[model samples]
Structures are given as C-alpha cells and as structure tokens.
Target: MKLPHDWFHADSEDKEMYGKELNLEMLSGHFLFSKNIEVYAHRNDATDDILCRHIDAEDLYTVVHLTWSMRPEIDNKHPTVEFHGSYDEFLQYNSKFFN
Candidate 1:
C-alpha cells in the first residue's frame, strides 16, 4: 500500500469548495481532510485525469477529468465531473482516452 505524502495530498480547501459547488452532499469539507478520500492514480497526459476512491462510500471509485481553462477571461471556472460505479466501468468507459 502506498502511504500518502506531500505529492499525494491535494488542495483540500479547493477540493472542498469544488465539492460543495458541485453539490456532492456526501463529500463535505471535513471529509476532504479525512482519510476516506484517496487519490490512487493519475493520467498525467493530455487528459490529466485522476482516479480516486471514496473509502467511506463503499469504496466508490471515480475518475475526475480535470479541464483546465486556458482562457480564464472567457471561462472563469471550469465545470463538469463524471462518475462511474466501479473501476472496471470507469476503465472500459474511458478506454479511448487511454492506451
């Protein structure tokens, strides 16, 4: 098992705020700081997607497809998050994005 270090840690405040903005009722600010959320893997390519698991929610895994806004003048905040029920589902669904 990989232990979380500085690299594994995310911006808790931003994540919490994002969760609230998305109306993720289960993912509270406190929950963001807890050990329940684990970001296991990431695709550091063009997609820049992350694979994380919500340990508290029956180990529910999700792939967060981060869309960075290059033109902040036009789009202030980037939105849109997709969720999958299982790891297999997520992988199979996103096969095209990966090798």
Candidate 2:
C-alpha cells in the first residue's frame, strides 16, 4: 500500500500532546498494508481510545481491528499495543477484540 509521505507528520504541539501516547509512525506502518481503512475516535479522548479496522492483502474478506494504547515513553523494546492472529484469523477473533 502506498502511503502519503506526510501521513505521519503532525504539528509540534499535537505531537507533544499525543505522540507518546500513540506513535503515528508505527501506526501508519501497520496500516500501510491495509485497504479500506477506517478509524474512530472516542468523544472524550480521541488519542486514548482509538479504534481502526481494515482489510489487508492476506485476508481480503476479514477486517483486522487494532486498538491503540498510550505508552509511557518512546520505547521500541515495548510495543504500544498488541494484536492476535494471522490476517486470516482476524475474523475469528474480531468480536473478541473489537466491539
């Protein structure tokens, strides 16, 4: 999937406020492979309760759901979130992960 070069660029203040909570670079990397991507934000704190869904090349019929979490710091050793299954199994566990 082709992503806009500026897709990960956020204003300094926006980055300072939410960049640590959700790494836009990592998130964009994951979604680069997605097709028909959709994102929803929580009314209260959009950064804290982000929900995204998309269909990847490996599973055209299944939509993979991803939930983002806030990271205490920028640590590549620890991922900000976790996901289960191969692309194909996303459907089987979709309901469990996503509402």
Candidate 3:
C-alpha cells in the first residue's frame, strides 16, 4: 500500500502506531488533528449550488462540503479547524494533535 508522504514504513524494530492519512500540508497552520474519523456532511438543501461554486473556484483542494449534524441529535454549529486548516489552532489542544 502507498503510505502517506509523511509516514514511514513499518519494520521489525518499529513499534506499531495507530493513525490515518491526512493532508498534513493542508493542516500546516491548523491545530486540529484526528484519525479514523468517518466524517459525514450534508448540504443545507443548497448542495448543488454550493458544489457548482466550488467546481468553478480554482482552489478545489480546500473546498469541503459539510452537513449539519455530528450525530442524530447534535448539529455542528460552527466551522472548526479541520475544515479550514486553521480553524482551531488557537484553542488549547490537550496534545491529542500528536497522538
């Protein structure tokens, strides 16, 4: 398998680690970091319009679509660091960014 650009291959002397692929460069200015998360987002009934705008915008890599819910009862109210790269860099991270 193709490991991500920032990770090294496992070897006999290596200790196993749990992690996932993320566009690290995309997180260059952000403090948000996570792994093994299956994110789901739905458009607010205007998905088509938003998608069209993104398709036309030149910076497609950073364009992301988000739904309104994190769980069946909870909704994501504000934009976060992972979504915009630097959305939560200023928040006090408990060091989970490295784990």
Worst 10 residues of 2 by lDDT: 1-10
TM per candidate comes to: 0.46, 0.26, 0.19
TM-score of 1: 0.46
Candidate models: Cα lDDT each: 0.47, 0.34, 0.24
Candidate 2 wrong stretches, greater than 4 Å: 1-57, 60-73, 77-79
Error of 1 at 12 (Å): 14
- Please list all clashing residue pairs in model 3, or write none if there are none: 41-67, 42-67, 81-87, 81-88
Say which prediction, candidate 1 or candidate 2, comes out ahead on lDDT.
1
Top of the candidates by TM-score: 1
List, residue by residue over 54-75, the lDDT tens digit for candidate 1.
7778746666654443322222
Model 1 poorest 10 in a row by lDDT: 70-79
* Overall local distance difference test of candidate 1: 0.47
- CA lDDT for candidate 2: 0.34
With a 3 Å backbone cut-off (N, CA, C), the pairs that clash in candidate 1 are: none
Q: Using lDDT as the measure, name the better of candidate 1 and candidate 3.
A: 1
Residue 62 displacement (Å), model 1: 1.1
| Runs in model 1 lying further than 4 Å from the true structure | 1-36, 67-79, 96-99
